[model samples]
Target: MNAEIIAVGTELLLGQIANTNAQYLSSELAQLGINVFYHTAVGDNSSRLKDVIKGAQQRSNLIIFTGGLGPTKDDLTKETVASVLSVELEHDQKALNQIEQYFQRTNRHMTENNKKQALVLKGATVFPNDNGMAPGIAYKNKDCLYLLFPGPPSELKLMFDKYGRSFLLEQLETKQFMESRVLRFFGIGESQLETEIEDLIDSQKNPTIAPLAGEGEVTLRLTAKDNSLDRVTEMLNKVEEEIQRRVGTFFYGYGTTSLHSELFKKLQEKKLTISSAESLTGGSFANELTSFNGASLVYQGSIVCYQNEVKEKLLNVSPQVIKEHGAVSFECAKQMAEQVRQTLNSDIGVSFTGVAGPAEQEGKPVGTVFIGISIKNSKTEVYTLKLSGSRNGIRNRAVKYANFYLLKLLS
Candidate 1:
């Protein structure tokens, strides 16, 4: 299962955007037990791409390509790949209909060049893109397997996950299904979490542990392969129990769950609605809570008090409180939270007030933050934090910290 991920885009070479497709595909391939040894990115040039493909063919059995599937002339991935496979391109009528319908549905004229996207390698399996115009293709030529995807990550990700994955599994004749569970954790660094379960990672055999860190959180992906689904579940749960024994305090939720989403669940279970009064974070704190559908069950509303006047006029923060302790102070944060709850008639209220900037406010340093929470009858609590990052990072972390505290308080 040796594979090489070839990303084709002049934009990628120019550093206009990241080659995230490579990273994503590599991770998914690993879950399928495919060994991705090389990741190569080339411009829209066919000769260079051909050379890369020839080299990949010499070493790898699976060649997966992303990018260059578009209406423009610069999009040459399919052409280059078809040439390498010694095949001609033929129009896929379904793909053509998709493009035609897309243009008509959006009330835009379909150009002649746009038809180029409907062309696929002859004798290739076509994956119709639900999100975009270009179609993904897969062809098994002798001993080598080739999969091509659209350049845009949105299209590529959906096509691969929804259709391409199953096709690959069938091509590989995989009997055992690979089951994966991602245990998400906050308030724990990757190194610390790994060290706590280093022995298990060291002795991994049937179930494998991979630790990944991203944006203020860490996750351990436990993967197990077994013919029986129940056996795979048992294996993963067994590993999870052992890991939880060591670092259960930080474990929050599972696969793709965020801190805010987990907190939203708890609020729903308690049948309590929440609101927010935000300052330095703007409406970001509220935005996080509302990102999930049905969040309104637990989230009432929010007030973005960017200025002192707004705080006084809308959320009814006393002018004296602002003058005495400043807007970024803990006293002001608590008052804002309490006032928002009273104003919105929500069961719980949260507030974020911070100096997240290039300059300090009220003599407090940048990244100085105070997150406040108010329950119906409980005393209002404020968590003070001195974080370090860019202004956006500081603001983003404020929302995360708020979610963390709310989860802990509820627990």
Candidate 2:
């Protein structure tokens, strides 16, 4: 089914709030095999909303609206929809009872205007709200379907998941199953990754390959549809294998897994302890690793040696090496990694030293990074990187590179 999402709120146009509801609904509809053709956001004005609704009816078979469902005067979403469809508005008794009980339970005064929350479009399927007072409505006008949800994200998400999804499924003429797999890759540019698998994308039929570039990473979403679940899974596996063969080295874990989480899991599984000696990142690498639970088992500790004095005193970097090769040099990183690992008695040690700044440091240009990895029973390895971005971006990417290198080592 072709669908269009209309977000109704003055706050959205004024930039007071984001229109994330449209984004959520679009993703959910895609999973249900519905095509979202357009997203339109309008203020809480009747005339403009009427125009938007009429335009949506002409082009899309399904129109979904979010926001402007409150007890205030500006909450005109249901009224506008009812007016456009030439249908009457009636109060839903069950919703009214719920609202009354809420007021009584809180010992608050219930004004006459508050009863407006119970009003819904006539002949519409009522979706009772579990989180808030505003009830959702779904109406079918001839060949077009209209769904109205509340403004708050909590209310809208619960209502849609509990009732709205099943209602849409029942409305579909044919039953089809859809499955999607997201393959995540790091340490590669989006353009290069796409170029490697451009043939697979162009000749896609049953399973579609769509590449998306995220912050510091790229993802390929493989979506397959069929009447039988087994056939859909087979199609996805086939496409994934071909894509993996082309760019498997850069591919990491699946779905929303990040480098830190994957690394933590691997360390725990292998029972390896880790420590960090952070210079430019200032313990950010340690912070990312320890954010996951049970990090104490895998993480030993971290030493933030931001200054040369601390590097020498804590991480035991020689003063001569800092004066000659500079603190942001390979020798400094290597020493820091080995010393931290030996100091904390961990199986692995990682170090980050770089110039990530507003100005160059020690005759080195900005974005010049050095990452060192030292593992027990192996030689130390240091990787050099020349990156480009703001100071914070460079620092963040440096930490990510450390995680990626360590992950590769452990794998």
Candidate 3:
């Protein structure tokens, strides 16, 4: 089934808010094997919204809308959609009662304008919003399915995941289901990865290969459509194997897993604990690891040695070593990693030392970085990089390379 998403808000066009709803809906519809051909955004003007809806109905079998379901006068999505569909609007008693209960629970007086939120188009299936006052609705009229949802991300996510998806899935009757696997890679450019598998991509038919690059990483999304889950998995494995044959060295983990997550998982799997001595990244590596739940099992601690004196005093790096090789050198990085691991008594140690720029430091160019990882009885390894971008970008990429190297070492 083909689907079209319409975002209704003046704020979106004015850059006051981003239209993230279209991205979410597109991904969701793709999982259901529905092709999302168009994404339309219109301001609060009802005539333009009507035109968009009328245009969508002529081309799409499903039209989904987000925003303009609030209490203000500018919230005219429901009214305009009702007018276009030749349907009447009536206040839903259940929705009105829920709105009243919400106001009562908060000890706030409900305004008469709040009643507008309870209005639903005639003969539409009401979707109760557990997260907010504005209820969603799904209806079918004239061979097109129309769905309305709130603009707030949290509320829209909850309503769609809880109710909207089930309605669409039931209405959709496609035998083929699309399954995708995202393989993430670091230390390899997107062009390099694609070039390695150019033959496979060129000859692709049943399973498609797509490469994406961002923030010093590359990802290959392998999508296959099949009725059976096992068949799709097998097809994906075959494609993955072909790609891995050429660019396997850079491939790290799969599907929604970041370098930090994969590093943490590898640490836990190998029963390793790590300590970090951070300089230019300012403890961002440790912060990223701790953001994942249950990271304390593998994360020992971190020391943010931003100052030269702190590096000498805390991580036990000699002042002469800093003077000789500079702080962003491989020698300094190795010492920092070894000292931090020995001090914290962790199985592994990681260090980030870099010159993230606006300006160069210690005669080293901006974006010059050295990441060091030390393991038990294993020689400390240092990876040097000359990255590009602003200070924050360089720092972020440095930390990511640190985790990527740590994962590789653990493997």
Candidate 4:
């Protein structure tokens, strides 16, 4: 079904609030193999809403409206929809009873205007709102299906999952299941990844590949639809295998997983503990690692040695090495890693030292980073990076690189 989502709120237009309801509904609709063509947001004005409704009726068969379902005068979604469809709004007895009971349970007097929350279009299927006072309505006028939901995310989500989803499913003549897999990658640019799989994307039919670039990472979402679940899974797997074969070296993990999370899981599984020595990153690596629960099991501690003296005294870097190579050198990073591992008695040690800058340091340019990893019973390893961005961006990317290298070591 071709769907359009109408979000009715002046606050959304004014940027006071986001229309998250459209995002949520679009995702849900995708799972059901329904394509959402447009998302239109209108202020709480009946005339503009009517114009939007008319435009939607010409293009989409499924029109879902969110917001403007409350007791306030600005809540005009149902009223405008009723006027457009030439149907009268009538009070649903069950909804009226529920609203009265809620006020009674709270021991508050129900104002006359509050009764408007019980209004529904004539000849509509009323979906009870378990979390709020406004009941959702689903009505078919001619060939179009109009579904009205509450603006609050909590109420809308619950009502849609409990009632609205099933209603849509029943209306479908043939049921088709859709599935998606998101492959997460780092250390690769989005354009480079796309180039590697450009053929697969260009000639795509059933399983479509979409690439999205996020903060220092990229993801490819592969979606497939079929009548049989097994067929859908097979189609998704086939596309994913080809994509993996092309750029599998950059692939780290699956959906919603980050470098730090993957490293945390690996450390826990291997029963290894780690410590960090931070310089330019300023303990950001340590903070990211310890944010996870039970992090103490895999994390010993961190030493933030921003100053040359602290590195010399705390991490025991030789003064001669600092004088010769400076603090942002590979020699300093290697020594810092080894010292932190030995001092904290951890299975592994990682160090981040660099010039993340508005200005260069020790003749090294900004974004010059050296990461060192010292694992027990293994030789210390250092990786040098020349990056670019804001200081905070460089720092954040450095922390992620630390996690990525540690994850590689543990793997």
Candidate 5:
């Protein structure tokens, strides 16, 4: 069944808060085979809210409302929905008792306004709130279903999982299982990847293919829907294989894998330790890798040698080489990688050196970068890039390049 989520709060419109509730609900609904077609955020005004609710009722069979379920007068979600549906509001005795007991346990006096949370719509199934005072409601009118949830995420999550999930599943009779697989790729643009797989995507029927690009990477999500879970998984596997066959060299780990994490995975699997010598990137590559848990096993450390003196003194690059080719050259990057591996006595070494600025440096133009990778007893290779972006952009792309190069060597 198709659904729409309505978030009620002025904080969202004013940018005081983010609408994370919609993101969470949409993901959960998708897993249940329910399509969330629209997301609407309205302020605390009852008139505007009533209009939104009335409009949603016409197009959507299932409407989930979040926020404005509190004691204050501004918390008007239930009131607005009741008015829109011409449903009577009545106080639930069990909910009122629970609220009173909570206040008694805390040794505090219960205010009259607090009882407003106990009010429920006539013929609605009351969802007991274990984490908050405001009880939520799920009710069906004619052929439409309305679900009310609390504003706070902690309370809303518990109530929805405890009660709302069963209600929706029963109403829709959603019994089919859906499976999805994500294939991540780097060193290739989204348009290029899509072009290569255009025929496969056009020929898709049972397993659908959708490409998404973000932050220097592209992902293809393949989804298959079937009544039997194993059958759906098998269908997704076949589709994934076909796509990978065309562009598998550019592909990395599957499902939420990042470049740094993928490199870290290889390092751990081989039981190999690595270190980095950072120049243009200023240790960002190392920082990203170390952010994951238990990174110490694969990552030794990093040295940010932004100056020629540091490169010469710490990494022991020959002074003559710097004078001849400059620090941003291919030779300097290769030496930086080899020296760091030798100095730290690591199994692998990676390096980044580039000109990242609005102006050129050392006869090299801005966005000129060289990424070096060195493995023990193996030939060191440097990948040159003439990227286009600001300093941070260049540095970010350089890091990705460094990881991609290292991943290629490791693989």
Candidate 6:
């Protein structure tokens, strides 16, 4: 089924609030094998909203709406929809009782206007709202299905996930369930990954493969649709294995797993403690790892040696090394990693030293970065990179590269 999501609110148009509801609904609908072709945001004007609804109804089978369901005067979603459908709003007793109990529990007086929240279409599937006053409405008009949901994210998510989904599921005659898996890769460009599997993507039918590129990483989302779980799993596994066979060395983890989390897991599994010495990144790598739970088991600490004086004094990077190879060089990065590992008494030490954008430093151009990794019984390794972006972007990319190298080493 195809759908168009309409966000009804002036605040969305004015940028006072975001239309996140459209994103949520689109994702949910995609899992049900429903295609979401358009997302439109219309203000509180009734005539314009009706026009949008008419246009959507002409193009799509499902018309989903978020917002404008309230007791206030500007809340005209149901009223306008009723006008278009040639139906009048009818008071739902169960909804009205729930609203009364809500006001009573909160020790508030229930005004007559509060009854507006309980009004539904003449004949509609009513979804009870445990989180708010307004009840959700789902109505069918000929070949089109109209769904109205509360604007508040908390209420809308609960109502849809708990009740609305079941209603839609009952209507679907042959359920074609879709499962998607994201394969994340670092140290590889999106175009490179896509080109490697261009033939596979071109020939794919049952499982669709899509490549997405981010700042310093790439992801391939493979979606498989099937009636049986085992058949879908088998198809997905076969495709995943084939993709991995082609580019398995660069592929790290799957399904929202990132470089930092993968590195932490590997370090914890090996019972190895790690420390970091940062330069341009300013401990961002350490901060990222520290945000995860149970990080203290493997994350020792980090030293932000942003200045040359601190690099020389705290991280024990020699002035001669800085003078000879510069602070952004492989020598300085290696020394920083080695010194931090020894000083912090960690099994693994990582370091980042770089020249971010806006200005060159020590005869090195901007975006020149060196990431260092040192293990107790092994030699220190330094990887050099020439990134592109603003100063903050370069620094962020430097931190990400540090995490990527750590994950690679641990793997």
Give the candidate number with the greatest lDDT. Answer: 4
TM-score of 4: 0.97
Candidate 2 weakest ten by summed lDDT: 26-35
Best by TM-score: 4
**Candidates' lDDT values, in order?**
0.91, 0.93, 0.90, 0.94, 0.90, 0.90
Worst 10 residues of 3 by lDDT: 169-178
lDDT of 1 by residue, 267-334 (tens): 98889999999998999988888888898788889999999999999999999999999999999999
TM-score per candidate, in order?
0.72, 0.93, 0.84, 0.97, 0.96, 0.94
User: Could you tell me the lDDT of residue 114 within candidate 2?
Assistant: 85
For candidate 2, write residues 340-378 as lDDT tens digits: 999999999999999998999999999999999999999
Candidate order by TM-score, decreasing, is 4, 5, 6, 2, 3, 1
Looking at model 3, residue 48 earns an lDDT score of 97
Better of 4 and 5 by lDDT: 4
Query: On residues 209-233, what C-alpha lDDT tens digit does candidate 4 reach at each position?
Result: 8999999999999999998989999
RMSD of each: 5.6, 2.1, 3.5, 1.3, 1.5, 1.9
**Best of the two (4, 6) by lDDT:** 4
Q: Model 2 Cα displacement at 51 (Å)?
A: 1.8
- Worst ten-residue run, lDDT, model 6? 402-411
Once fitted onto the true fold, the runs of candidate 5 whose alpha carbons sit more than 4 angstroms away are: 203-205
Pick out the ten consecutive residues of candidate 5 with the lowest summed lDDT. 171-180
Per-residue lDDT value at 275 in model 5: 96
Residues 1-411 of candidate 3: C-alpha lDDT, one tens digit per residue: 789999999989999988898999898877777888999999999999999998998999999999999999999999999999889999999999999999999999999999999999988999998999989999899789999999999999999999998888888676567788999999998887788889999999879998899788999899988878789889999989988888988989988889988888888888889999999899898889999888889889999999989999998999999998888899999999999999999998889898998889999899899988889899999899999998999999988888777777777
